[model samples]
Structures are given as structure tokens and as C-alpha cells.
Target: MSSNSNSNSGRRRPALLVLDLINEIVHPDGKYAADGYFAQARDRSVLERTAEAIARARAADIPVIYVVVGFSADYTEWPAGSPVFEKARADGRLKLGTWATQVHDALAPEPGEPVVAKHRISPFHGTNLELLLRTREIDTLLLTGVSTELVVLTTAQAGHDLDFRVQVLEDATLAGDAEIHAAALKVLSRIATVTTVEGALPSTG
Candidate 1:
């Protein structure tokens, strides 16, 4: 982990946690592209905004951690009855080692940056995310990613419950619709600090 002078004992060391910015959820050719959610997100340029935030985090020497969702080719780990994973399994998307599961080219994880694969919505669930955070002494998470009503919201709430100071980068996340996105941000404001990408950046001045 790179050191940042802005982070001291008085404040928790911050890391940027990007959730589910995978090709399957972001790219137009992805399996879920038929649903048009990814198309809308791309149209709004959420990926570009996320990339900008990532660049700022890197410049500040803050840890950039990626949380992606994927399943095995057989998808045996995916529960049959679960509404979420079941549909994903049926669609045959997010297969491990496939382009769909891979993070988008626009915001790829550089060498040595931790890329954590998650089986569920929360980054902490069934992943080494908590260990990575604790190991790096990261207590403040700058959350950014797709599906504001799903992964971003769930991860922010989970991070808060785990006693980490969480902030959701509003422009860095996208939902299926504007109302859902706005609503998620409003509810998340109660549990986490809701801010823009620039707001999460370290002050260079």
C-alpha cells in the first residue's frame, strides 16, 4: 500500500473499492446487454467518470481494490432457487476467466492492485476483501461501481456495519433507472457519506 499524508491517526486510511465494474455489467456486448441497463449506463458515461476517480485515487497513492462478481463454468456454487444468481446462471454470464467476468478495459487493475472476486453483492461476503482492508489498515472505503441499487448500496451498508467509514461516489455508480439510483443514494446518505468522485479525491492543493 502506498502512503498518503492526508491519512493520519485522526482519520482512517482510505482505499478505493470498485465493485462489479466487470464487462458483463458494463459493456454493450455483455450478456446482460439485452436488458439495456448497461447501455443506459454507458450512455451516461458512468465508466468514464469511474475511470477518472480511479486515476485520482492512484495519483493520491490510495489503494485501488476491485470487487468483481463471477461464477465457475459449471456454476455449481450458484444456488438454484436464488432469484439473483439463478438468472445469472441461466444467462451463462460472468463465467470465471471469460471476458464477461473480466474488469472493463477502461478501468483495469494495474499490477499489484488487489482484485477480489465476490460470490455475492457485498464485497466482504465470501471474499478476501476484509483481510485485504485490514492488512492495509484501510478503514475508509471510497465506494464506486455499477448498479447503485444493488452492489454499491449493499457494499456501502455492509462496510458501515463492519465499522468502516464508507463513502459512495455518486457519479461513479449507475443503476437501472434514475429514480432507483437517486433513491439508493438518498438511503445510503443515512448510513454512509454520499459524495461525488471529486469530493472523494485527496486535496492536491
Candidate 2:
């Protein structure tokens, strides 16, 4: 799918949002790896594509904001009735300050980059993501992450509702399987610009 050109006259200020690429979610040894996320990521080379996107954003002087999902050791932030986080709570995974919650090394944030910790699917829900974007005058969001049907889709919708131009880097995201990933991208195309890392960034040449 291709992105529509920006209609606004002013230049668009953009930021790259790397969401839930943490070890517990995307890494091969992650808690959810057995469920097929790792396999899909490996086949798609999601990490490599996302790393390229991050590098492009940095070279273009665009901000790169990292969003990670995790909760306190006591699991207080977790939703008791939510099936999405039930496994995490039961297995005691995704606790803050743990390696499972850290961003994968391949696409790890630079020292001064902003890493926003979230407890829910949508990063903007209880996090300062909006504030950070507003402070930086970023009017566009380039999204890349794991679980295409979950975090990527949710964030795209939320970003659209918040009046930001949202673009999903399809190659940089993974899901349970190829079909699931394609379906999520189809849905996301309705509300966001579904594109590749190369399409989202400028050419280095």
C-alpha cells in the first residue's frame, strides 16, 4: 500500500515510534516467542528493517521515540480482567527493570533517546507520548513495532484520533503469522498510511 501525500503546505515534522520491540515480546527467547511472534519476526527480518528505519530517522534529524510495555513488580498496573496481559501476570513477565522489558539490542535506543514505558496497548493512554510529541512539534508519526494486530494497530488508530499523521512501517512490524500481519495492515491502511521503511524515510543517497 502507498501513502497519500501530505496536503498541508507546511513541512511535516515527523517522529519514529518504535513500539514494544522489547525482549519479552519480540526476542526468540521471549515469553511470547512460542506463540509465533519470534518466527514471524525472523522470517520478515523485522528487527533489521526497524533498525534501518531508526537510522534513517536519526540521519534526517527526526526524533525517535521508543515505547515499551511493562508493569511494576507487584503487577498493579496490569488489567486483572484483560486476557491480553493474563499470561504476563501469571508468568511474572514484563516487570520493569528486568531484561525481558528492555528493548532488543538490535534496535536499542540511543543514550538520550526517549523511551516511554507503557502498561497498556495504546502508548498514548497513560503515557506522556502526546506531550513529548507536542513539545517537539511533531505532527507526523512513523510507527514500527511487534504484534501488528495489537500495538501497531491500536497506536495507529489512537494517533489518527489525536490528529497526527500516522504511517505504519509494514516491513518493520511482526505478528503471530503472515496472514495475521497482512490482515492487520489491511485494517491499518484505512486509518493510517501503511508503507515500508524505505517509503517512510528519505534516501541516504
Candidate 3:
């Protein structure tokens, strides 16, 4: 079905799901910089593109929702033996209330925009994301954020399985490596409509 299509009926209630584009992962001095993911995000100008996407979505009256990843100060929510989050807990990154956990300044959420904090890569895991979407009646999601191979890929598939119309904004997401980004996009195209920021927006002309 088209991104604007709803599961129960042919109605469109679209929203933008901005995932994990926080300082803890996207900035040059982020705690995960040593992992080399931030470098790729910067090179790809993910923040700039995401900023543009937010602007376009807002202009089109689309709900803009941010999904941020952070942990309790005591690291209580850090899942045990999880490869994706083990290093973060060990290195003390993504501490709540820290500057590193804030969304990238370029794409800071405006007033009234919902910011969903999640502990896992998938925004829906252990979070109220589904509830929020259901409340807003949003069934079509425009997914954007860092590490296309992980969060973006996972969320796209999950969103599809959940009966939501999903679309991945190519220019607005970043990955650890160019090859990985390309491969994820290729795979995601099968489950979701992969488009650039401009293409994802409704035509003003």
C-alpha cells in the first residue's frame, strides 16, 4: 500500500519519525565517534538533510516525532549482553540529561513536537511510540536518523510488519560506512519506499 494508506481504511495520517540523530552518535565529538559512525554521518551531512526534512514536514503540516536513544544515569536500562549497547554502557555514553544525548542542534525539535526516548535501537522497543502514533492516528511514517544499517533498517521492517506505511528518507539517514548504507537502502527498498528528502515531501507545485 502507499505510504499515505491506512490499515483500517484508505485514509492518510502521515507523520515523520526522526530517530536517534542525537549528539551522542552524530556529532564529531560524540562518545561514539571512535566507532567511526559520526564521521560518516558528518560526511553525508545527515544533520543538514534532516533539518531540511523537518522543515519540509512542518511546512506540509506533518507531525514531526523524534526518537532519541539514551540511558538512565545509572545505566539500568542497558540490555545485558546486547552487542549494540554493550559498548555504550561500558564507555559511559548516552547518559540522560547530558549534552551528548540531545538531538543534533540543527534539527532540534520545535515546541509541541513529541520526542520519544528509547533505550534500544528500535524506537518501538520499551517505548510509547506506538501509543503516540495510535493517538495521533498516524499510520504512514517517514523514517529518518543515523546508522541506516541498524535503527533505520530495523524500524522500517518493524513498521511495515506493524501495518504502517513506511518510507525511508535516504538523504536524512546516516550509516557507519558508505557500503553498509547502500546495502541497507537496497534491502529496505523491498519493504519500504526509499526516497530522498525532497521526494518524500508532498509537491508544493
Best by lDDT: 2
* Model 2 CA deviation exceeding 4 Å by range: 1-9
TM-score of each: 0.92, 0.95, 0.93
Per-residue lDDT over 1-205 for candidate 2, one digit per residue giving the tens place of the 0 to 100 score: 1123344535788999999999987888899888898888888899999999999999999999999999999998999888888898888999988999999999988989999999999999899999999888788999999889999999999888878899999999989899999999999999999899999996787
Alpha-carbon shift of residue 2 in model 3 (angstroms)? 14
Q: Could you give candidate 1's per-residue lDDT for residues 92-195 as a string of tens digits?
A: 87888899989999999999999998777777888889889888888889998878988988988888777788899998898877888899999999999999
Clashes of each: 0, 0, 0
Error of 2 at 195 (Å): 0.6
Model 1, position 117: C-alpha lDDT score: 85
Q: Candidate 3: worst 10 consecutive residues by lDDT?
A: 1-10
Q: Give the Å error, residue 11, model 1.
A: 2.9
Model 1 pairs in collision? none
